[model samples]
Target: MDVDGEERIAAPREVVWHALNDPEILRQCIPGCQSLEKTSPTELVTTVRIKIGPVGATFNGEITLSNINAPESYTISGEGKGGIAGFGKGAADVVLIEDGDETILRYAAKAQVGGKLAQLGSRLIDSASRKLAQQFFADFNAAVAADGQT
Candidate 1:
């Protein structure tokens, strides 16, 4: 599966970047995310409850950052296992650019799934992934804006 998308946040680049990396902001933005922790400057550990169609599982994963350019761009790759439900791994290249006072967040991501998830078919996976990504960014934008207002 591949995901190519972008969102323009109505905030400064610095504000967008700060919200992007903040654990609290991320947890609130990521759907089904129960916990997220920064194990290292370039690594994150996460736990999320996922439900696709009739399958539900808890995924515990670690994500590593590479090709980082700080507040501008980075590459993230992560793999997660949900017991018998199977495993998922994905890589995304994210870029951020200033658009006046706003920041545009662009990303290209590819993913592979195995086990029960793959059995559900590509259409389902693709739809779910896009929905999740959209929700995350929407939440992120709202959170960032709220923080600025307060």
Candidate 2:
């Protein structure tokens, strides 16, 4: 599945960039993310719980950032396993464009699933992925805006 979207954040590009790299901020913004630990400047280990259709499971994953260009752009890829539920892997390219005091965040992502999760059908998985992406961005925008105010 492919997913892409853009969001306008009421903060500077630098602030947005920092928030994106900060594990604490990411943990707060990512939907279903139970914990996120940054093991290195370019890698993070995470635990996330999600429910799709009639199945619910917790997934452990590692995400790595590459082709980083500071407050400009980067590519992130990760894979997760949920035991009997299934597994998922995906990659996203993110760009941050400065718009005066605000920043325009854009992303293009693709994901794949296997096992029981894949058996649930593409339509269902696509819908769920889109929703989760939307939620994460909304939360991220709000959190960054709020953080800027403090």
Error of 2 at 2 (Å): 0.5
**Model 2 bad stretches (over 4 Å):** none
- For model 1, residues 20-90, the per-residue Cα lDDT tens digits are 77888988898999999999988999999989888889999998989988889889899999999999999
User: How displaced is residue 122 in candidate 1, in Å?
Assistant: 0.4
Q: Which residue pairs clash in candidate 2? A: none
Expressed as tens digits, the lDDT of each residue in 52-142 for candidate 2 is 9988899999999999999899999999999999999999999999999999999999999998999999999999999999899899999
| C-alpha RMSD in Å of predicted model 1 compared with the true structure | 0.9
Clashing pairs in 1: none
| Model 1 TM-score, all chains together | 0.96
- What are the root-mean-square deviations of the candidates from the true structure over C-alphas? 0.9, 0.7
In model 2, the Cα lDDT at residue 85 comes to 91
